[model samples]
Target: MYKNILAAVDGSSHGDAVVEAVASLAKLTGATVQVIHVRPSQVIGGAIASTVVPVEEREESQRVVDAAVARLRGDGVTADGEVDEGLREELAAILIERSEALGSDLIAVGPGHYSGISGLLHPSVSRGVAKISHVSVLLVRSES
Candidate 1:
């Protein structure tokens, strides 16, 4: 019953399943879907080491998002994608902001690395967003 859905992703192997799950849900509900990738900001920048993601990362991100978009399109679903970079918490906030700006009704994210009780304590994107967002958030289990 959602009209607007935002799905955040990283190019992890788990992303394939997450995209599939999000696309399936969107298709079923006839909801518009937006795929997102947040490039991690450089926590420490120096000649020695930097947490900043390389520019090549965006190319890889595009590959992932393009594949996901094609899959959704193949299913006759409307989809779009965006790539941004910031801290993880900021990434989550960006997703929420975009969802609202785009008039999204729901946000979808995959389960965290933990399982069961630990997972709840960890509270992945879905859990965190649900608590923080003005819109509904869905937790999708990755088949990986």
Candidate 2:
């Protein structure tokens, strides 16, 4: 049974699915939910590009978290949210850190891209989160 749940949202294609899944779980277990969206770090360009994310982008990340929290609340779940950013760490690391900070019992993640050459370039979110997190992780696969 989960007490506090941390749902990671990125406004991706599976964003809604993730919220819906987490809401169901939270409702069933009578647990509260905290949604978070990590602002993507700056991508280094050719040789040595700036590693800082734009201010607007960071604000947008917070908006994403707010929206997810709103959706969860609309589903009659007690939910709040926060925005996180990483200077050098990936999203998975950020999510795990936030979960620990919030004392979340479960970290819920949506489906990850696992096909084609692009998938090979980055590690899947679920795997990365599970590998680094101390608590349980729920990977809600996208409804095909």
Candidate 3:
């Protein structure tokens, strides 16, 4: 049984499935859920790009966290959320660090969305977390 559950969302279509899976698991285990949305920084014109995410993008990320938290609370599950910024490649490390900081016993995340050649090109955050995490991981596959 997990004491604390870390749920990672990217505001993608798979986000809902991740939240729902976390809710169900938390309800069963009586665990508190901490939802996180990581806003990936992009590289542009051979530059590392700005640290500050666009206002609109930040708002959207907050919305994603808020909605997930609300849905979990509405399900009578204890939950909270946070929005973080990091490079796309560092997403797994960020999630791992956050989860460790919060003492999360389990991490629930969406399935990797990439496929075929594109999948080979882009690293999957979910896969990375699963491979290196010290805690248990639940990959909630969405029907999208």
Candidate 4:
């Protein structure tokens, strides 16, 4: 019953599962997908720094979004790409904001399967998004 889906991708290994989930959902519901990649912004002096992003970072972000959009479209689903900066906020907050702004009915996110000390240091974005999101959230976890 979803008309529009917002898929949050980071070009990680788990990202593929998120895309697959979104593509299948879109195909079943005849919905369009909007793939987004949010780059974490640097903080300076307790505030978000508005510094110019390096060319390499921008290109990588674009590449992630482009690949996601291509995959969704290749599945015969209408799809588009977006790149955003999470300034002084968590990635979850940005995704929620974009979903509301885009009027998306659902949000698909991957946990990325962080493990060991790294997982403890870095909290799960999908968990945060699912907790605070106004719209429905689909947590796509990697099987491996």
Q: Which candidate has the top score in TM-score? A: 3
* TM values, all candidates: 0.78, 0.85, 0.90, 0.85
Q: How large is the C-alpha RMSD of every model relative to the true structure? A: 4.3, 2.5, 2.5, 3.1
RMSD of 2: 2.5
State the displacement of the C-alpha of residue 58, model 3, in Å, after optimal TM-score superposition.
Answer: 0.3
Q: Give the Cα lDDT of each candidate.
A: 0.74, 0.82, 0.89, 0.84
How many steric clashes between backbone atoms does each model show? 0, 0, 0, 0
lDDT of 4 by residue, 1-144 (tens): 999999999888788889999999999999999999987664445346445333238888899999999988889999999998865247788899899999999999987466899577566788888888888999888776
Candidate 4: segments with Cα more than 4 A from true spot: 44-56, 87-89
Tens-digit lDDT track for model 2 on 19-42? 989999989999999998776664
Residue 4 C-alpha lDDT in model 2: 95
C-alpha lDDT (0 to 100) for residue 75 of candidate 1: 81
Residue 21 local lDDT, model 1: 80
When 2 and 4 are scored with lDDT, the better candidate is 4
C-alpha displacement of 111 in model 1, angstroms?
2.0
Tell me the tens digit of each residue's lDDT in model 3 across 35-79.
Answer: 999877754443554343432388889999999999999999999
* Cα lDDT, model 4, residue 42: 46
TM-score of 4: 0.85
lDDT of 3: 0.89
Off by over 4 Å in 3: 47-56, 116-118
